[model samples]
Target: MLGSISLDKTTRRVSLRAKALMIFSILLAPGCLGSDEEIDVFYGEDIVPPRATPDFVLFDQNGDPVAFNDYLGDVVVVAFLFTRCPDVCPQVSANMAWIGNELGDNLGTEVHLLSITVDPWYDNSSVMQNYAYDRGLEWPHLSSDLETMEPIWRSFDVGLETYANDTDGDGTVDGFDLCPDTPEGEQTDADGCGVETQQSEGDVQTMHHPLYYIDHTTGTIIVDRAGNQRVYWGDFVWNADMVLDDIMALVEESA
Candidate 1:
């Protein structure tokens, strides 16, 4: 179950729809490994990240420049996202929102979260801000031009990923398909959408760019006090309780 928020801010909807499924990284059995003395130092998908996250200068929702170091002294949960992604990313954000709510006093104190875009070409600071606000998000939703963000993606080892909307469940993608979101189970033409697909609201594209909508990377990383990456989960396949346990442990340790 997703945890509840008790922070100073008024309670906000956590999901577009109620009680969305919560996903985490791959799970590990508690006793599957050897015994008492050895510590379960890492959880979910383990990573060998750099001693500290590479410093990044990116644009915030307000179009102002912000850097990674600005969040120093707080353990940061960082993820890469794109606005139009239809899948995993949205759920990931919801999960983070739950975490943020749970953090309460710890937020901006012991913990902070950052989300950078993989499709910065399409998701400018303005677009990103709208996306974050729509989702009732509190963390930074950041981006820059594709050229400026490529190095950041490289440093984090995440590739650009997106998908086209087939609003009518059409077999083909939007741009070349000329039609999109074909009605479910309906037989479609070569374009994979029906003749009326154009009338569908999905036809309109965004302001800055026309990139494919994408799925989230389904990963999150935790950086500790010394700036070392402490944990990483490649997908939302594990448990939030475990994450909370680990995060609280780290927060106390850092204190």
Candidate 2:
């Protein structure tokens, strides 16, 4: 596990924990911190600096346009993944869902979660909504046309997932998982779409807005109120408890 201060934008990072690949696991060096402090675990590809974030607008799952700057005053945890992600993508989003639940009432008030789709050509509005609803996510799951999202992807160095899978056991793959979050014990049609209404539909979704090519490349960026990109977690750092600790510490420090 590796953790350290990020000096500049080109800081290459690597996780200090083991990463799960397919059904096997790869043990790695541990680098988690008991307290919240600036730590860099980047292996390569230099750490992207805490520079001024450019403003970009995209339709969320609910099909509403939102500006990134609008989230400045809140603690925002952003991840790059598509609903059809087979392995790490679902794992990363599931981690965020865990965090969102743990945040309790502070979810929308003090903190927010952002999942941006790297695959736009297929992950349209409906697919985005199903992805979040199935994951018990209360945050905005975003995506857009490739032309609109190209720069956004490049800006954040988020790898595009040109493909997808049926990770939800709902029978539908990412691009076609229209009813992504079918409730457990519920029967789904030929498509993976399931009824989450009887279950928990935490937050509403928006549409047209929004990775999985690199190893342990599931990047999570925590942006503070001031928009100074604060903490950065590697692909394998999906432990909700560990992330919750770091986020809480950071929020407390900022206050």
What lDDT score belongs to each candidate, Candidate 1 first? 0.64, 0.61
Off by over 4 Å in 2: 1-49, 161-216
TM-score attained by model 1: 0.67
Residues forming the 10-long window of minimal summed lDDT in candidate 2: 18-27
Cα RMSD, model 2: 13.9
TM-score of each: 0.67, 0.60
lDDT of 1 by residue, 1-255 (tens): 566534322222222111211211112345444454332344454454334667888988888898887776778887777786655678778778878877778888888888888876578988898999998996788888878887777666665555665555555556435545556765545444454444455544322223354544446777776666667766556466456545655565446
> Which predicted model would earn the best lDDT?
1
Among the numbered candidates, top TM-score falls to 1
After the best TM-score superposition of candidate 2, give how far the Cα of residue 28 lies from its true spot, in angstroms: 31
